[model samples]
Target: MERDVVCLVDGNKHLYDRGAYLWTLRPSIVNRIRRDYPKARNQDFICFEHLLPYQVEMIQSMMRSDEKQIDKLNRKLTRTMEDQEYRVTDVNETLKETQTFGQKIADRVAEIAGSWGFIIFYIIVLVGWIVINGLHVFGITFDPYPFILLNLFLSCIAALQAPVIMMSQNRAAYRDRMSSENDYHINLKTEEELRILHAKMDHLMQHQFDHNLEIQAMIFEILSEIRITQKK
Candidate 1:
């Protein structure tokens, strides 16, 4: 009859069953334990107890590494968020902050020209001018039948107002672009935070599963010891 084999780790000896103990463990788990206990080279003759401190430490080390990586990402994202907040990225605020004398004048002019009040008032002035000139009530016609001077005045106003509106529009477009970029950065940070949360959760769940398995193994060991004692 073959006697049961025994294994040594950390100066403690335990039963070694190839079929029940050795084969049941994962290769990575075995490798990590072997790495920690360098003297345990002959694993076939060596056995490890359930819930080893070294195995727990290995899991904690892995969790620490994951936490460190998440912290690094958090720091980077925080800096980016701070930078974005510090700068004036708001479209209206940026336009107001960077407004030059000429830009302010252009924006004001565009605002007035774009209003319904300005349109209605200009229409009234045009009609009054045409009526006054057509009736010749004052017996003096400043802009005659063809209204050549009126045409020139309107053309000049159009040329000047077009450039001003275009300048204001350009500034608005630049402000909008800056706001869009800031929004993208905010969204990216949010996504990174969510990813970190998911990774941490996965790590914790895996650690818990391993711990539960170790606890079950320890229970089995206690049950085996009780059975042997009862027989003796």
Candidate 2:
């Protein structure tokens, strides 16, 4: 028992239930109708045949907006990756490239001095020196039991070796600091990329849901038209 109304655009009679009132439509659709029919009123009715065009336009607009947002996110991610690329480097290779001849020598000396081979060799030399001097072997009793000359030699070796080892250790600390900074930069960049990806995913999901709802509305409208035709 639905009443009939004239379509605003085509002036054709249609069931009131098969059309939409201007006031109940979305603002975008209302504006589109107003553009075509400048004298259109909030209470005017439009048949589904004319309404379909505006609904399609709205869906296309949403799709375009989603594309623009995705493009913007892609550009942002590219810039972020480019900016972080220069900050990460191999600390070991960089240190090696900048090392001085003296630093190389110091590192070599420290390496040799820290080994068990060096310890054993040093003990053997010391024992040999003591036995040869104390026993006066081969009539070599030049510096008898006190061994002042041997003590001076040991002191000089200690002084030189200490500074060399310290120099190598300082370089090692510098290398560690540079390595830590590089790791931090890499981690920061990864975190930012992940955050941007999450935002992009959320945006896509929200828009996809909106699109699904719009499509579902279109399906319902089509079903209503089919039922109205069958009843006739």
For TM-score, the strongest prediction is 2
Tell me how candidate 2 scores on lDDT.
0.87
**lDDT tens readout by residue for model 2, 1-232:** 4588989998899888777899988888799889989999999999877887887787677778878989999998898889946498988889999999999999999999999999999999988888899998887876678888889889999999999999999999999899999999999999989999998898878876777787678668667765765675
- In candidate 1, where is summed lDDT lowest over 10 consecutive residues? 14-23
TM-score of 2: 0.86
Cα displacement (angstroms), candidate 2, residue 104, comes to 1.3
Error of 2 at 89 (Å): 1.0
Q: Which ten residues in a row have the lowest lDDT in candidate 2?
A: 223-232
Steric clash pairs (candidate 1): 7-46, 7-47
Superposition TM-score, candidate 1 onto the true structure:
0.60
